[model samples]
Target: MRAAIHDERGVAAIEFGIMIPILSLMVVSVTDIGLAVFRKMQVEDAAQAGAQYAIIHGFDASGISSAVTSATNSTAVTASPGPVKFYGCPTGTGVSVVSAGTVCTGGAQAGTYATVSAQATYYTLINYQIIAVAYTYNAQSTTRLQ
Candidate 1:
């Protein structure tokens, strides 16, 4: 009836019902975002660990990847293939770095550096691939060799 439409009774209930889904979505989004950030930090730490390992023990692809995998301690993340890269550069002055190609062992100079990268894919809670809701995440670290 027109009087029922004009009346404000039960409006709060209707509003609450409408807001509930939006609030729930917000909560889920926040939770997912927090988890994504945590995962990103873990990946970054893994990359840093791998880079440090390479710096100390020289570049061993398997060892570096193992370090990454161990650091994360999660099966959801997979270390990228050929994650280690070596750069040779002049030390103690203006420097130019050149890629050591595929081979890295015994190729680094005093000022040379090693870079390690880690990557993983996180499946999103919502299925929205067009918005990049789920995609590959990458982390990288570089350390100068001693």
Candidate 2:
């Protein structure tokens, strides 16, 4: 009687098939996480830029935003990318400020100075999902003022 042997080709194919999907998934996950971090930074920087603009120029929130946009990615800040918005000034003080921009309005007699806040959103290709679903990521930013 001669010794019998079985083919290993099928086993190799099976292993390869299983590993390909897992490897692909791992690559995709890494890419997604990196993108998320990048976008979050963008939002924060944009907000800071907006506030900085107000601080130096006085009013004209748009001007600061424009500076930020020019410095960074404008598309990341806004879907349409219009002028930076300013709103809600204190009743007196005569310093132009926006209410929404102001974080805590009443620190020094209602118009002494205002704290400013700004926000920006970033988009990513990865859509987070749970149990077969999808989601969108939202990024935000804020700044402080006198």
Candidate 3:
């Protein structure tokens, strides 16, 4: 008769089988979170960029749109909510900007401040080829560059 010693050969396969699922979940979760953060930052940058362009250019909606378009360089951006009409400012009080026309019309002064909200819709790619789950993301940022 012979003797049996500790080999631990099959133990590795068992451990790996247990760890794969956990590892995959962690990786996908991280990916989802990272993508969300990235999308949020992108929208914020676009909004603030549009606002800056508006304050400097003044009453030019297309220019602001172009600025954000240049910032995002994507078709997902919608600049229609602005230039956001300004209704109360240059009177030592803050400006109240609304949406109706292509630019601020009535309540804005020469040095009045304005703000605009930018939105970006993100479609996450999750498939059996990529990961085996589904996800979607929508990010928004209200940038005050004025």
Candidate that beats the other on lDDT, 1 or 3, i.e. the better one: 1
Candidate 1 residue pairs that clash: none
lDDT of 2 by residue, 1-146 (tens): 23335545578789999999899878987886687677667655665665566666765655755755654554655322333343434446544554543444555432333233334544444454642233233333323343
TM-score of 3: 0.64
Q: Model 1: per-residue lDDT, tens digit, 31-113?
A: 88888888888888888889888878887889888888888778766568546454666546533566554333357443556
Q: How many clashing pairs in candidate 1?
A: 0
Give the TM-score of each candidate: 0.73, 0.57, 0.64
Model 1 misplaced stretches (Cα beyond 4 Å): 1-8, 85-87, 90-96, 99-112, 128-130
Write the residue-wise lDDT of candidate 3 on 1-116 in tens digits: 23345665688899999999999977977787687677767777887788777766775667877777678766666554665534432324444454433244454433334555
Model 1 quality (TM-score):
0.73
Error of 3 at 109 (Å): 8.1
Ranking 1 against 3 by TM-score, winner = 1
**What lDDT would candidate 1 get against the real structure?**
0.74
